[model samples]
Target: MTTDPPPEPNREPTPGRLHRARTAFRRWRRTRPFWAAVWTGLGGFVIFFLPMAPLGKILQVGLGGIAGMAGGVLLMAMALLILLLPGQRHTAGVIAVIAGVASFPLSNLGGLFVGMVLSVLGGSMAFAWLPEKPARRRRPRRTTPSAETPVSLGSGSA
Candidate 1:
């Protein structure tokens, strides 16, 4: 007799569309908000470090720290607060967006440009990412006979 082919070692049945969608939602729900906040913080931190660059240094020498770097420092502080405080993320998201916009004048460096973009994206994502509610399962209804059918109490009167 010819031998049947062996089953694939670790293969499993593919999930249905609904199952796959639900799984994707669960994964996104878990990470999207956290990553958004992280990006915002990272952007702000980058803005803070722009001063160490050669171009930034030259500008720093000319403009002094107050006019050149204060906005970056403020942005960094706001980002750090957002990262450190979980309960205030909504507020932090608002702050991050504001600071990212305001930081434009701080250093006017490439880092500020990159940081502004990232912080805006991250802050908006943080504000907008909401967890999806699970679909509720409904019970099937049992149909009962309506009207017409009469029941006798065994009177035997025919």
Candidate 2:
């Protein structure tokens, strides 16, 4: 089979296309401000539900309510910093990670310790390799029949 070469790239917008596109975008950003606001509000509402979340759970775990607000704000600032560098990375995901790491010492130390020990033990026990069970010699069955099994079928088939 023959392979085909790649096609050439066409990189020009014709005439007033770019201008119209920019104008349309600007018009959208301005005219749809209500939708933008609603979306922003919805996003915040969703963020509020993050598990072991940076903004809420972090604040609650890290400090009391008044300080919780401050903690939440700081968490958001950290998220914004994580978000600054690029194409479609989630600061919240990173924040969740940090929160997971940081919250370790604050609560459930006993549970954590137990879980770690159990996990390690489980892994080691799982893979340390037990010897195969000693192969049992096949025992010759007794000719005597039990009452439950049909004696004719089991013992005296003609």
Top model by lDDT, which number? 1
Candidate 1, residues 55-114: lDDT per residue as tens digits?
Answer: 665664665334335555665565566555655667777877877776666556525489
Index of the highest-TM-score prediction: 1
Candidate 2 — worst ten consecutive residues by lDDT sum? 32-41
TM-score of each: 0.54, 0.22
104-153: candidate 2 lDDT, tens digit per residue: 34334312433223222322222232334556999998887678776454
Full-model lDDT for every candidate: 0.67, 0.37
Off by over 4 Å in 2: 1-63, 87-96, 100-158
**What local lDDT score does residue 79 receive in model 2, on the 0 to 100 scale?**
36
Kindly provide the TM-score of model 1 when superposed on the true structure, using C-alpha atoms.
0.54
Range of the 10 consecutive residues with the lowest summed lDDT in candidate 1: 63-72
